[model samples]
Target: MSPQPQAAVGAPLSRVDGRLKVTGKADYTADHDVRGAVHAVVVGSRVALGRITALDIRAALAQPGVLRVISHLDAPRLAYRDNPGAFMDPPVGERLRVFQDDRVRFCGQPVAVVVARTLEAARHAAHLVRVSYRAERPSTDLTAPDLPVNDPLPPQDYERGTPKEALAAAEVRLEAVYRLARVHHNAMEPHATIARWDGDRLIVWDKTQWVQGTQNELAAVFGIPPDSVRVISPFVGGAFGNAARVWPHSTIAALAARVTGLPVKLVLTREQLYHGVGYRPAYTYTLRLGSDRRGRLAGMVHGIRAETSAYEHFLEGTVTPGRMLYATPHVGQTYRTVPLDVNTPTYMRGPGYATAAFAVESALDELAHELGIDPIEMRLRNETAQDPSNGLPFSTRRLRECLRVGAGAFHWDRRAPAPRATRDGDWLIGTGVAVGCYDTLRLGAQARVRLDADGTALVESASSDMGPGTYTSMTQLAADALGLNMRKVTFRLGDSLMPGSPPHAGSLTMASVGSAVQDGCDRLRRQAIGLAVGDEGSPLYGAEDDDVVVLGGRLRVRGNPARTETYERLLARNHRTHLEVLGSFTPPSEPERSSMYAFGATFAEVAVDARLGMVRVRRMLGVYDAGRIISPKLAESQALGAMVGGIGQALLEHTVTDHRDGRIVNANLTDYLVPVNADVPDLRAIYLDGGADLDAAPIGVKGLGEVVAVGVAPAVANAVFHATGRRVRDLPITVEALL
Candidate 1:
């Protein structure tokens, strides 16, 4: 069939839901006004690891307006049926069970809950609840000398060739150890859940990336039918990856409501959020690279370690870049998850690729310096045509274009080759570049579309909008497919009763859910056109179906503009109410025919004060090769926002923990630092404008949210090295290290 004229797909339209958000009408999780809802405060264990020896809740129960105090001694035993975990769950161990035992596995583990008539009453009573513990020295440090080390799972270790022997035979070798500090999500809106029960059925308004996942997990925890639970989350302030998993606070809210026979609301305090949610785990990466005099990579060896909780093993795609990013004859890697007395880590914005890029990209920069070659030229020399891990052709690999375009845009020719040569009044200036990539993840999704006789449409799926503008992008696709004005369509999401959708993370929402919406809208439009052509009284009767086009809810023949009929007249004459279709998309289950990934290049300019040891970024630019840009405005938002986050990862963000008691020292915003308006300088994003890769998905979009943040840190780090001639192997390139 002939494609419809492009109208809204590529347009740079503002968010469809922007008016509601700015006027304080958007309903986030905490904004839901459930009737008869009382506040519940969670009481956390003070010690990192211990066994509860004494229970004390009399003081909490006696506080004014406090209805009840629930703890392990009195809380009911949940069924906790075997839940075949969600997409983000680690396959190794079970999730943390809340209030089911006396053993404490980590600091700030929920020990008790205080439910009261008001939030103030709950807070006061929770502080009065106390317990005694028989504590032991906790293993919280990943590199402590006395801490026992647990080898990583066998499946994580990988090798392609004889890397050690090849490294020994190389003409030049480089080795470096890099460290990254753990960081929290710290979204604007705190994690919250409001749960209530009605005749053995549960209802919750939660801050979750996937409402269906929350519904399934809650049903499994209570041993009830999955259909009996309903989850609603219309708007999410921001999650990054913290809300991807079903955390303990969600279960605790439902439990409180069930025990007290009242709707219960729970919101974690800022300090509690540090220990309650997951974070980007600290990493120790030791890399060894062997290269020739001409900067050709021969072999590489990687030693990686990350911290996870003792109860569970969490892993990510940390070693994928080493296996496929460049051309190499031999590669070996060992990934180990160190068991520590801390909460398990989860995926942050960039996840594994961001961590690996710092080590790999920085090593490549060092090799370029030694070989007296430009960094971009060195990377281009080792670019791979096929994935080395599987020997499969790439659906689309645009790293070369990204690097080339970025070089010209960032003015690479003006950069001085020597370090500490370019200096201002009190600062040294330099520029650096690095390449970034992320896997184009695909998953199954479903969407429902309905075209009413009134010429308006409604499209819905259980997707979410966590600051990426899913509502606006999906609406754009639907409007273009249905050939209707953008103002005539409505898009709704974030409810479990809608059609199923994948989680909002992984950068797959646009590729998966957007495709489903397009399919459904196209089908619905075809139904309308077919109806009009079949009716004997219609002006478009007997017209060639393929030649018919829709614009402004009117069906007309392509060559004959006079043959036209509005949808309202045709549907009213035929006595039809509406046309409805359910669109679904499922990725191939067989082995992938081609490797699919989104690529980008990051360039940064920085200035450093050698006397006071201060580093400041002056400007940054990112060039991305993500497949198609459905909404140019939203795409710019994702790219520019991620660059800011990358700045934080390089210079300011760190989750400080006191290992002695397993306490997080800098948990609040006042102590923890993020990039402020004053800290951010000039920033820009450029897309390669390469059309589409149908092999990746139906909508022809490779994911962008994660890849845009991948190489940001190393670019800044390399710039600091060029500016001051000091190489700091750790993240947040601290002032003390520079001095």
Candidate 2:
């Protein structure tokens, strides 16, 4: 059977909520109107790690409108239950309990809360509450964190072939240690939450990408039934991965509301954002690669260490790329999260893949130079149709196509083979390329669809749209499936009251939640068609189910447009008010027939000052083989944003921490650095035509958001190496490294 022709899915439609956002009509988490709501500001501990010695709150209670002060001394000890709701892969260790004890595991940890009638009163009262602690020197340095506390990932050590022997027998070998600085997700909107208690039930408006995650976490921590907590997050300004987890601030708000018998609101300040929320932990990866004289890999080994909190051991898929990206006969990898005196790190954008690619891609570029091979050619020689780690055939891998397209667009032919050979006066111009890949993960999801008699539909799901176009993308799916105009459909999300859903990260929203929406719309369309055909008064009473189709809210026979009936007329004749249906998508429990992942190639052009050690990215291009383009405009935006993130990772962004005290020194935007308009270049994206993965989902899309930034940093780093005769192993290749 032929695929259904899409009218709105691939079109470059503007965001459906763009008008409301620009007109300031959309409501964010803190913008909602909650009756009898009050302010709640947190008071963080000053010490990096130690025990709280004394806490005096006499002056704070004297302040006007100060309802109550909750701290470890006075507050009731919570159940502090354990659950794997906040992206816990295997439930390694216990999660942090707010105000449960006096031990400060990390700096800026919340120890007390100040609740009042107004935000000003809360801020003033919080300062008045004096806190003294016996500080202890924290082990905050990222060089070599404490190891082997707990490893949730299976196969903590993996060996495919005789890697040791292959390395010893290789003709050419390269060994280096690549370091990436600690990074933070500086989303546009700060994390905010408002928790209200009514009897035994709790309703919360929060800034989170996963409402179910917050609900589960809240229920687990307080020892309440999961249904008792309701999380609502209709709109989010921006969230890469910071809003995916249930942070300590969220739990505090709920606890404060229940304790005070009033609605409590909590917002994290910019300084607290550095330590309160999870950030990409700093990493030190020592990689050793052995290849034949012709640039063919003989063996590869990865020794890695990353930072995590003393309580929870967080881990990601950092070793998967080294084992699978390139076809090596012998491979060994060990990924360990070192326990430290810091906050528990969580997923950030590409997460483990982005960090791993920095080492692998950069090493591949170095090996190509040793063999006198083109960078792009060097990767193509090692590309395999099947995953080397698992030996499964890829459902659809277009990495070769992406590289070819990006090379053609970037004009890869006009380049010198030797480093420092291409110089334009003061600026040395050069180009570099790298490949990126991400496994397209999918899960079961459900949605509720209601179609009114007036040719309008409302779809609800427990999902989120944190800067990505969830509202717009889901609307397009419903519009195309039901043959209704885009304006006739209204999609709702970011509410726990809706059907259950998975976390909004991992670029799986389109494949998982989107399939559910399509299923619901299809069922609703079939109900209307059945009503028209079964009725004797209908124009096409004898038409078959497949013969009838919906078009512009009218039911017509496939061949005869004259034989048509409007939904309004049919519903009036049938005496029906509306049609409602439940749609669901359950991913196959059986093992997948093939490996599925999204692939892309990033090309970067850089100009470096040979004398001054200055690097400027003049322009860049990305060619993606991400399965299908759900929304053309948003897909392009994802590409551009990923490129920007890549630029920051390569040259500018870093979270500086005072290793002596384990305090984030550069917490605010003024102190920390990010890529601004002046730093961005002429960015462009090209998605392959008909690049849909039918095996992945019904919508034929793999995932775009995560893969765009996977290889970006390495691409920029390689470009810098080509411009100047400098091979910097550390990230943010600073001026000192070049000189």
Candidate 3:
């Protein structure tokens, strides 16, 4: 199909749902008004590693408005079937079996649930339901000695020439260890679920990224057919990654509803967020790079240790870019998962790339300094036009352009080379830059497009918005694809009753689900065209099907606007009611052999107080080559939001757990800081002009959601290093570290 005019794809269109959201008419999961819904509060274990000895629910059951207290002892028996495919990581070994057997592996594991008429009553009753345990010392440290190491893959060693020999042959070599603190997905909306059972059918309204995943999990838990359960999540406030999986709280809410025979609503408190869901596991990365005096990289080696829960093995893509980023004859990486006494960790924003980029980019910057070379020049000299891992050409890589544009925009030529040379009063001002990269991921997605004779269109998919404007972008794409105005199109999502679609993650929503929408709209448009041309009495009758096209809500010839007729007029003449088409986009079985990734360059300017040890970001700019952008406004919003999130990860966010009792000390938002409006200033994003291989996907879009955040931390850290001459490897670059 030939490309249509860029009416909605590249236009800076505002969100279609902006009015609904701003007017408080959009319905989130918690906003659902389920009649006769009772509140349920969870009672968590106080110890991290222990055996629950006794439980007392007598006082809680006697409280006013308290309906029931359900624990493992009183809860209904489940099938306890083990299915690894059901979850991202299967429930293996003694799965804390909520309330059944009290062998707590982590602190805040649900021990009991209190159901009552009011949220306050349930909360108070939960506090009264006491439990005792036999506690043991827990391993909270990521670098502790007793951490069990699991080998996810064999030694990923690549060598065209010996790296040791290359290092010895090279004139300059730089090695450094980078530490990243554990970061939480502090999304604005907390995880919540309202579960009810009607006979054998289970209906749940959950705040989740994957509605089908939750349905599958609930089916497995209850040993019921998956078709019997329905998961509805029409809106999600924000889910960085925390809502990607079904947590224990969700299961507890379902159990509470089933046991008490009433609709139960559960909302996790801020404190429970620290232990209930997944987080970005702390990482300790050691990197060694060998480069010549001319700044050509000869060899590289990386060693990484990431934290995981004792019960399950969690692994991230820590070694992905190491094999493909630069051309290195000798490269070796050893990625190990260190099992600690904590809940399993999952992907957070950029996941492994964010951690890996910090080490790799920081090491590259260090090497540039060692060689006395400009960082941009050094990167360009060592840039690989093809994927070194598989030897495939890039689909489209303008990383060099990104660097050039960013350097010009950031005034890199004016930066002082020496640390602490630029000062403003008591503050040291320095600028730093780093490269960002993330893979272009595509998954199977389905969408339905319906065009009525009334000149209105409706698009439905099971994908999620999650505060990234999925509804608005998909609506815009549909409006353009079907030749209808934005006002005449309605996009519906976040409900399992719609056509099956992939989860909204991996930055693939636009490429995957949006492609599906395009397919559906094209099919619907063609059906309308067929209807117009097939009728002998119609104006387009006897016209070649190939020459007929739909635009501006009219059936017209490709180049002749005089022979055009409005869709409503055509439909009225033909006595047609409506045209509907169901379309799906499954990724091609054989993708073209190319390095498909979204790339960017982040430049940061930081101001450091020499006396009080404070670091503040003055300005930041991100230059991106993330394929064809569908909505420029939303894309810019996503980039800016990611930079803000990166600022939090690099400076303020940390889930501090007290190892003495396995309690999270700073779980509340008041103690755990995030970047406020006053903390972030003057951030901008610039997207390059171009699209990747059109054959890659229908929309020719590479994922951009995660790429914006991949390089932000390192840029800020590099700036801090240049500002105060202090090389802090750990995250949050605390005031104490600067002192």
lDDT of 3 at 490: 94
Candidate 3 residue runs with Cα over 4 Å from true position: 1-3, 80-96, 151-161
lDDT scores of the candidates, listed in order: 0.90, 0.88, 0.85
Looking at model 1, the pairs that clash are: none
Among all candidates shown, the one with the greatest lDDT = 1
Candidate that beats the other on TM-score, 1 or 3, i.e. the better one: 1
lDDT of 2: 0.88
Instruction: Give lDDT tens digits, candidate 1, residues 1-739.
Output: 5688779988999999999999999999989999999999999999999999887889889988999888888889998887774545553676888989999999999999999999999999999987999998898988786554555456578898999998999999999999999978889999999999998999999999999989989999999998999999999999999898888999999999999999999999999889888999999999999999999999999999988888888888899998999999899999988889998889998899999999999999999998999889999999999999999999999889999999999999899999898999999998888888999987889999988889889999999999999999999999889988899899999999999998999999999999899889889888888888889999999987898989887888998999998888988899878889998888889998999999999999999996998889999999999999898888888988988998899999998888899988888999999989987989999988965878899888998999999999999999998898888889878889899
Q: Residue by residue across 1-739, what tens digits does model 2's lDDT show?
A: 1123478989999999999999999999888889999999999888789999999999999999999989999887787677765563633677777888889998899999999999999999999999999999887777843445445545467899999889999999999999999889988789999999989898999999999989988888888898999999999988888888889999999999999999998988988888888988789998999998889999998998888887888888788788888889899887777778888888888989999999999999999998999999999999999989899998898889999999899999888888888988999987888898998889889999988989898999999999879999999999888888899999999999899788888999999999999999899888888888899999979888888878788888887889998888999899888999989898888888888889899999999887898888999999988998989999999999999988988998888878888878899999788899998999999999888898899889998999999989999999999988688888887878887
- Stretches off by above 4 angstroms in model 2 are 1-5, 86-91, 144-155
Instruction: Summarize candidate 3's per-residue lDDT along 303-388 as a digit string, tens digits.
Output: 88888888877777778878777878778788887877888888889878999998988888888877888878888998888888
Using TM-score as the measure, the top candidate is 1
TM-score of each: 0.99, 0.98, 0.97
Clashes of each: 0, 1, 2
Which of the predicted structures, 1 or 3, would earn the higher lDDT when compared with the native?
Answer: 1
Lowest summed-lDDT stretch of 10 residues in model 3?
87-96
Query: Which is the winner by lDDT between candidate 2 and candidate 3?
Result: 2
